[model samples]
Target: MATKYAMLARTSRLQSVASTEELEEATTELQNFTVAAGTLIKVASEQSAPTDDLQVFVYDPVLREPNTTRKYQCAQDSLLPVSDDLWPFIVSIPEPNRRLQLVQDSSRCNWLYTAMPGDVVSVPARYFDRDDFRLFECIICYIGPVPEIHPVGYFFGLELLDDVQSPQTADISFTRKYFECDADAAIFITADRILPTPLPQDEEIESANEAPESSWSLTNFIQNTVDSIRASLPL
Candidate 1:
């Protein structure tokens, strides 16, 4: 059996996206951002879900660094031997959310997992007003061998597309072509957001006192605030 893994974003965006139109709009905006940034590999909608609650998948080809060996092992134990033959990438929202939930129960929180070096996942889409769009940097920390036995840990980073540029369409076979190519290519994530594990202890202390770098950290901030509130409530 594939060794199961779970991811928790130390920081992310968790909004109550209850409306289908809103979700669709968000999907369009996400796709536009991908094309504008030139990170799009493949995108498609979940055929089984309701149209309003449509879930889109986006795949970006990412480069794997040598340092991620251990982290990759934790998520995929047997794949290392065949790693060279398969593409290294990360899937965007909804699918990861679903995959994670398949193994464990988490609240209804929408998020995109950071692209890890050796992980393979399904990919999301769509347009929106400038004010409705914002760039977010997410640091996803992985911990597992779930149900928490023999755990290993590390961090993966992803930056949500922020800018508005003209959208470009790829041929339907784009994803297949990408997988066939043997070149070492990757869709780039923001260099500043890629935080590796074993963070300095002092950095951890300083992070508590300092403000987050961007509004993207609002998800983390909100989650922390809610936890604090719950802790303070009468037992």
Candidate 2:
């Protein structure tokens, strides 16, 4: 059986900036500060809307314990306003659309039930076992032997946020392993309330087997023809 996981990380403060340029400047400054503090910085989104500038969420990997000293220092150094209410959190849910029930000893936060656009969720990568990879691929890409139009080319991040042990933190080695394995367990942003695509029945699989075989044969034939032509025209 496939296991799903969820994590929550509190946002200590929300810094509102005047413009996009200022937001970028603030993000860069925070990134540099993390680097100076010997911590890895994980930026959730590359593009930010004007409203997103209302809160700049920074995940600090170095500070494992829940201490406000460094967080305060970082906020002070960056000159960003810190919100008194630290209830807002970024929650990562593995399976979407399913009602998330609180597990015993599990981490909790304010936005545990709601999913935001920039929220990072984990899914098994393509490098996993054939069945597991196909399961996720069918759900995420939606191009598994179906003639109907489906979404594709969704990007994933090669880093797993470890919020269980330490809230809103990830180890450098843990993040590196994803890239090393060609992204064994990559994280993706939830564009909407995503749900897993149902697996095809046995009869459906039997019918689709021939298509793949034909496709493979045609690909091999093209490659062989190219090789033959190259051999004949050898200098």
Candidate 3:
């Protein structure tokens, strides 16, 4: 009977994945679904036809390919509130193919993001000091959300362009590929641990000319991010 609700739709299990084909199959069971844990849904206050269930959409920036919406039905009791410091940051990422740097957040949270191929990035020595690695720069040659590594985030497949070597390939979780590079030169990282690398001066000038000034300045960026996350919620 509730009207508007904001919730994170999640699987009770460690993972729940279904092939789009399997999902389309009439006989596919409810246990076989693609709604992984931590997916976000906002109720628009509309009751679905016949079943009288509340209609909603399950979306995870980490799971959806190319970013699409999946409509779902659920009882009012099934929903839960959304609260997290990282989701707002995830929603604010700029376009794919931008340069980035990976870091290990002291907060113990790595990030989950939907990255496309051809993005350039780097990792600093400070991040991996405990490990033998010193430093490296890399380009994101491939990206995929499926074969979910963890419901927490999207992993990357990096092709290292620096002196640091790797022992992984372009794969994730082994069962699937997190952003993998080559077995000879690969390392996987989550979004929370990554930061964008700034573009060069010449390219920055060209980008400025290509687009009008945006409101992403120091003061405005925080304001805009807050506004965007607030507007996105159904609360």
Best by lDDT: 3
Q: Which pairs clash in model 2?
A: none
C-alpha root-mean-square deviation, each candidate: 24.4, 19.8, 17.5
lDDT of 1: 0.27
How many pairs of residues in model 1 come into backbone collision? 13
Worst 10 residues of 1 by lDDT: 69-78
The full ranking of all candidates by lDDT, starting with the best, is 3, 2, 1
The TM-score between candidate 3 and the true structure equals 0.36
Residue-wise C-alpha lDDT for candidate 3, range 167-197, written one tens digit per residue? 3434433522444434557666545445555
**Residue 234 lDDT in candidate 3:** 100
lDDT of candidate 2 over 45-73, digit per residue (tens): 23234333212233333332232222212
**Each model's lDDT:** 0.27, 0.30, 0.49
Candidate 1: regions farther than 4 A off: 1-63, 68-87, 91-130, 133-235
Residue 232, candidate 3: C-alpha displacement in angstroms: 60
Whole-model lDDT for model 3 versus the true structure?
0.49
